[model samples]
Target: MTLLALAGCSSPDGGSQASPTITTTAAQATTAASKPGSRIFGLSDNQTAALDYLTTLEDRHAPFVSDDRLLALHRGGEICVDLDNGMSFSDLVASWKPELREDGAKLYVRAAVEKLCQDNRSKVPA
Candidate 1:
């Protein structure tokens, strides 16, 4: 009876959720993105210019892109760039759907980006 009860208690799905395995490449990128400094790589001149412009905006503002904000923005951009060179916030989040099930860190990274983007929308060039 106890054995039957135990079996009955098992999840109908038959397996526990699996954790996401953050790839070494992703990890490295994340580390770089999370760093407390300006990031200059893999950007076209235009993109670099745009980033520079944003930095200027940050400097002008009282609560500019702090370390955490920079990390989130950079990491989010990295994930987007990896999934699709021209990926936007919506696109990157969509691509990371599968990863969210396994690892929440990706979601965290994405959220950080979203927040940064939201906060900096005024600074973004049209």
Candidate 2:
């Protein structure tokens, strides 16, 4: 009886638990996707440039900015941009390529940025 119980416990299908490894890349991708429109908010060139500078500084000196500053910049940029000019979320997503690349934020950053732009645009006066 004890031998049978041990055998059952040791069975490959019975005791093997599938462990999903979450790598930094995977986590970053998940974070980017889950947040949707959270990194870029369709800012104008001036606003984009200023935020870019701030983000660069944060990236160089303050890693914490990676977590919160980017979101704040996105919000501020959305407020600064004149959305009545017909800018779409797709445009903002495309525009974020440089920043995303610089930050190593994952490929989905573009999609997230675009989603954010779209979400912000949705709230604008149409």
Candidate 3:
């Protein structure tokens, strides 16, 4: 979870900023998420939930193409931060999705707001 938060603090120019590396096996991610306050792999429940939500998006044919798991999660965190800064749904949809189609963009935005920025859910239009 710390890694997820750390990875997002990068240069806006998309320069050669070094990414934080987190090395853990699949079993470690699962085990770390299951135990409360147990950050063996540094994956908290909220972090794991966001990651799992992304998996569902992929299942629904809205997959994001990042081989590194943290990259996807970091992007999700960025979406949440945008919402924190009062970026509306329409604006988020327009700015957040880079290579994704309309449907995929909606999925990504909705999933990020739901899992990562739940407090702002009611602010979004249904």
Tell me each candidate's TM-score.
0.24, 0.25, 0.57
TM-score of 1: 0.24
Worst 10 residues of 2 by lDDT: 1-10
- CA lDDT of each candidate? 0.37, 0.38, 0.60
Give per-residue lDDT, candidate 3, residue 115. Answer: 55
Over 8-108, each residue of candidate 1 has an lDDT whose tens digit, in order, gives 33346886544333233544444444432323232221233224333443443313223333443345445534433344545555565564432344344
Q: After superposing candidate 2 on the true structure, give the runs of residues whose Cα lies further than 4 Å from its correct spot.
A: 1-71, 74-76, 79-82, 101-126
RMSD (Cα, Å) for all candidates, in order, is: 16.8, 17.6, 9.8
Candidate 1 residue spans exceeding 4 A from truth: 1-77, 80-85, 102-110, 114-126
The TM-score, computed over Cα atoms with residue i paired to residue i, of candidate 3 is: 0.57
Best candidate, TM-score = 3
Ranking by TM-score: 3, 2, 1
Better of 2 and 3 by TM-score: 3
Clashes of each: 1, 1, 1
lDDT computed for candidate 2: 0.38
- Candidate 1 overall lDDT versus native: 0.37
